[model samples]
Target: MVFQPASGYFCRALGAVLVIAATGAIAFAQLTIDADSQYRYAQSRFDSGAFDEAIVEFNRFIHFFSTDPRVPRARFQTGMAHFNTGQFQAAAAIFNQQTVNYQGLPLDNEAFFMLSRSHARKGMFEQAMLDLHNLMAIASAADTIDQARYELGWLHVDQGRWNEADQAFGQITPENQDRFQVLNLQQALALSDAIPTKNPTTAGWLSIVPGAGQLYGQRYQDALTAFLINSGLIWAAWESFDNDQYALGSVISFVGFGFYAGNIFSAVASAHKYNRDRVAEYRDLLNQRRQMPLSLVPSPGGAALCLTIDF
Candidate 1:
């Protein structure tokens, strides 16, 4: 009953297992290093504003390290690269996919925020608002919720929904609320009544008088031109008929009818154009005063939202 030396086959098998495990460990370590290097390189590109290059590097990292923990981050950066390059459609697609695939994760929050921004950049305000609402619903952190509300407020402002904007701004924490108020948003909102608007219906009705509609929209030159043309054609048609020029009179009358109808349509369209232009000018002024100023930047602890104020 004494211990004996193990068999040659057992020793050889043990050696083989050790060799395999060592090889795997080395391979894993090398993979980790490579992944980190690639990620850092991509980030450097992004930081330098070389967005096109950053996109390529980020994609490369994701492709080569699909299972790495940083894969999600790389994917996010790729979406951001597209966004920075003004490729809103591509960026939205990426963020939408990320939000769907990474639901309930921190990445999902970022994806939702970026998706809303992408939609907003494309002037899809409704879609952007929906995205922000979704973010607010899923977000657990106070700061994230505040960020969502802030963006929602801006979207409301973009739509000229002043009351809604105020509500959204009111939901923010008091500390940040003061910053929003400094935009003189109240002053801009007060000017709402002062913005002159033309009723398309009134314009169309006035146009029945040929040029009256245009005058109502304050288009004096158009009114004069329309009135002169309509009157001149009417006179010419009447003169032709008086001279027994039946063919000429009929042709002139038809032409006059077309011009008369066109004048009415022009007035209606002019009124719409006037209103549209006025609202646009107002929004432009608001935009100049109401900058978001908050942006997400990379930090040692995941990411941080930073607000920049320009004095």
Candidate 2:
């Protein structure tokens, strides 16, 4: 998921003011009343899950009471409304502001928690983890701690850091255990140990044989394709040279050389890509395991099969 700005309705509603004059002959009007009333209506609408109307009202509240002390609370509420409606970015911004302006307020921890959630929803795992860390540091509430740890583990899982995710999940106490969390951690930990093996250097393999690097990198199709093309060119070059067609042989020889060069380059690139993919896979697995209650169990050789068979 990615973060996106709020809809234009809030901005538009904030910009337009409907001023009602108390008397036709007088210019005096109920400015404060209008703002408060609009805010109250928005709150009521939000309570009923009418996010669209709530958004309209909240925008008006911000517009009318931009300097009021209640503005922070209003902003937080607006952000929650946006979140419930699936506006992740909007919710993130509101929650962030709530944290900054109402640091000592009782809702500060809640704001931080929501900020983490918004970041997670947007796939900003690093940012979400930072917020979760902060929440864990400051929040003493049992439920809050549990929620933060669970979300933190999820962020790790999203990034494929299975070990880290396992650690995070392991922090959850038995009192807070849930079936979903347990199952998720088990799956992530299993994946961490289930990836296919790969050779360290494709270059070494390619040096031994033209397309061996590609094969080592598990690119069987590419290896076969390169081998066929290069072999054909080599054969053609040899045949021309044997028939005393020096010029034709020279051209064919150069073509074969080009194929050889390309094979080497492809082999190096494949090796690098393979290594990167391997790291990413492990990292993501570790991240998922971070939220689980299970810890990493070390094996004698630092590797072990995650599956068992009954024979």
Instruction: Return the top candidate by TM-score.
Output: 1
| Model 2: residues with Cα > 4 Å off, grouped in runs | 1-57, 65-73, 77-93, 101-107, 117-124, 183-187, 200-208, 244-250, 267-311
Each prediction's whole-model lDDT (CA): 0.84, 0.71
lDDT of 1 by residue, 148-222 (tens): 888788789878887787778778886666766733666677687788899999999998888999999999999
Judge candidate 2 at residue 179 and give its lDDT. 37
Alpha-carbon error at 301 in model 1, in Å? 8.1
Model 1, residue pairs in steric clash? none
Q: Cα deviation of 252 in candidate 1 (Å)? A: 0.4
> Residue by residue across 1-311, what tens digits does model 2's lDDT show?
97656766666655553323224324445333665577668779987989888888878888877886556667767887888888889899988877774443345766787788788778787898999888777777776677678777766766767678778778887777673365566565766676655554646566446778788888889889888888889889999999999999999999889888888788878877887787676765555444332222222235222221111
Q: Considering every candidate listed, which one attains the maximal lDDT?
A: 1
lDDT of 1: 0.84
